[model samples]
Target chain A: DAGVTQSPTHLIKTRGQQVTLRCSPKSGHDTVSWYQQALGQGPQFIFQYYEEEERQRGNFPDRFSGHQFPNYSSELNVNALLLGDSALYLCASSRGQGSEKLFFGSGTQLSVL
Target chain B: GIQVEQSPPDLILQEGANSTLRCNFSDSVNNLQWFHQNPWGQLINLFYIPSGTKQNGRLSATTVATERYSLLYISSSQTTDSGVYFCAVEEYSSASKIIFGSGTRLSIRP
Candidate 1:
C-alpha cells in the first residue's frame, strides 16, 4: 500500500504569486490535513479537509486555503505568497477526521524568493 | 488554545545510548502522537499513543492523559535515529485540530 504522497517535492515561487501543492492521501484514508514547518520550528496546522469541505483551520490567514476531492486527495493553495511563506508543507492523512493516527508525506519544500 | 511544550530542545549522544523526551500539554487530550522529522524534513509517525504505554522495537512511548503529558523513550540509539521528535495533541472537544510541541532535536553520533 502506498503512503501519503505529495507532488513537486520542491518548488520556487516569487512574491505576489500564487502556488498550489497537491497531496494524495494514503489508501483507505479519507481525511487530509496540511501543515507548515518553518526553519527550526515544528509543523503548524494550516487546515483540515473532510467531506470535501474545510472542517477546521488554524491561526493562518485567508491567504491559505485547501480543497479535498471525492477521491480523498487534497490541494493546498497559497495566494500572494510572501518571503515568509517559504517552508516545508506537510500533508497528513488518517482514516477519518477524528482518527488518532496520522500518516504524513515527505512534504513539499516551498521556497519563496 | 492548548499549549504544548517539549523539554531538552537539543541533545547529542553516542551510539548505544538511551534518551527520554518529554511533552507536556496545557489541557486534556483525546489524541496524542509522536513524530520523528528526518534530516530531509519528513515527518515520520512514531506513535499514536493517547494513553497508557506502547512499545515498538527500540522505541517506546507513554502518555498520561489525565496528567496531560507524554514521554518517548529511545533505547540503543543509532545514528540513523538522529532527528527532531515532535509531540502533537488533539483535545477531545476539538476533533479536527492538533497542537504540536516545538520538538526535541536528538543527534546520535557513531
Candidate 2:
C-alpha cells in the first residue's frame, strides 16, 4: 500500500531560500501530519491536516506552513529557511484525526546551508 | 500540552538477550504507540497499546493507562533491533497532538 510516500528524499537549500516537501498518505487514509526530527531527538509535531484543512498546530512558526489536497496528499513549505531548520522532515498518515496508529514515510532529509 | 519521557536513554545488549524499555507521560492520554526508527530514518510502528497488554511474536507491550506509563519488552534481541525506540502519546482533547519522547537507543552486539 506504499504505507506513506514522501517526495524529494533529500534536499539542499541555502539560508533565506524556500523549500517544499510533499507527501502522499496511505491508501484510504484521510489524515496527514507533519513532523520535524533533529539529530538524536524524537520527532516533534509541526501540524496536522484533515479534510484539507489544518486541524492542529505545534510550536513551529508561520514559516512552516502546509497544505492538504482533496486526495489526502500534503505539502510542507518552509519560507526563509534558517540553518537551524536543517533536519529530517517526516510525514505520517492515519485513518482519522483521532486515531493514533500512524504510518510514517521515509523522511526527507533537509540540509539548510 | 503533554510531556512524555522514556527511560534508559541508551542500552547495549548481546544477541539473544532480553530487555525492557519504559515510557512515562505527564498527562492523561487517549492513545499510546511505540515506534522504531531505523538507520535509514524510517519510523516503523511497533505497537498501538493505549491500555492493557499485546504480544507480537517476540515483542510485547503493556500500557498502564491509570499510571500514565507503558513498557516494551523485547525478547531474544537481534542485531536488527539496534535502533531508536520511541514512545508517543495522544493527549485527551478535541485537538490531538501526538508527542514523542526523547527515545531509547538500543544497540545489540553480535
Candidate 3:
C-alpha cells in the first residue's frame, strides 16, 4: 500500500502571500496531523484533525490553520507567509486521535522569500 | 507543556561502530516514537515503543516509561545510517499532539 503522500514536494512564495499544502493519509488511517520542521530543528506540532474537525492545536499563531476532509486527507494553510515560515512541512497520520503509531509523508518544503 | 530532550546532539562514527541515543521526556506519555530523517528528508519510522523493548534488525529501542526515558541502540552502524534521529512523544494531557525533540544528528562514515 502507498504510504502517506504530500504535494507539492517544494514551493516558493513571497511575504504576505497565502499558501496551502496538501496531504493524503495512509490507507486505514483516520487522523491527520501537521508539523513544521525548520532547518536544524525537529518537527513541531502545528495541529491535528479527526472526524473532519480540528481536535488539537499547538502554540502556533492564528495565521496557521488546517482542514481535514471526509476521506481523511488534510490541508495546511498559512496566511501571510513570513520568511521565517520557510521550513519543511510534515504530515503524519494515525489510526485514531490518540497517541498511536504514526506514518509520515515525505513533507513539503516551503520557501518564503 | 511537556518537554522532550534528546542527547548526544551530534555523533560521528565509523561504519561497523555502535552508538546509543537517549531521549528524556518531562512527563508520562501514552506513546513514544523514534524517527530517522534521511538526507533526502524522509522521516522513516524506526520504532513505536511506548514502555518496552523492540528490536528491528541491528537497531533496538527500549523505553523505561516509569523513568520517562528511552534509549536507541544502533549496532554495526552503516554509512546509510547517516541522518538525524528524533524522539517524539504524546502525553496524556496533550490530546493527540506529538512533541518532538531537537534530534541527534548521526553521521556514519564509511
Chain B TM-score, all predictions listed: 0.97, 0.97, 0.98
Ordered list by DockQ, greatest first: 3, 1, 2
DockQ of 1: 0.85
Interface RMSD, in order shown: 0.9, 1.2, 0.7
DockQ-superior candidate, 1 or 2: 1
Candidate 1, residue A89: lDDT: 97
Measured with C-alpha atoms, the lDDT of residue B2 in candidate 2 is 87
> Tens digits of per-residue lDDT for model 2 on A1-113?
57899999999999999999999999989999999999999999999999999999999999999999999999999999999999999999998888668999999999999
* Model 2 global lDDT (CA atoms, 0 to 1): 0.95
Clashing pairs in 1: none
Better of 1 and 3 by lDDT: 3
The single-chain TM-score for chain B of candidate 1 is: 0.97
- TM, every model: 0.98, 0.98, 0.99
Q: After superposition, how far is residue B96 of candidate 2 from its true place, in Å?
A: 2.4
- The collision pairs in model 2 are none
Q: Model 2: runs farther than 4 Å from truth?
A: none
Q: Candidate 3 — what's its lDDT?
A: 0.95
Alpha-carbon RMSD, candidate 1: 0.8
| Model 3 stretches with alpha carbons more than 4 Å out | none
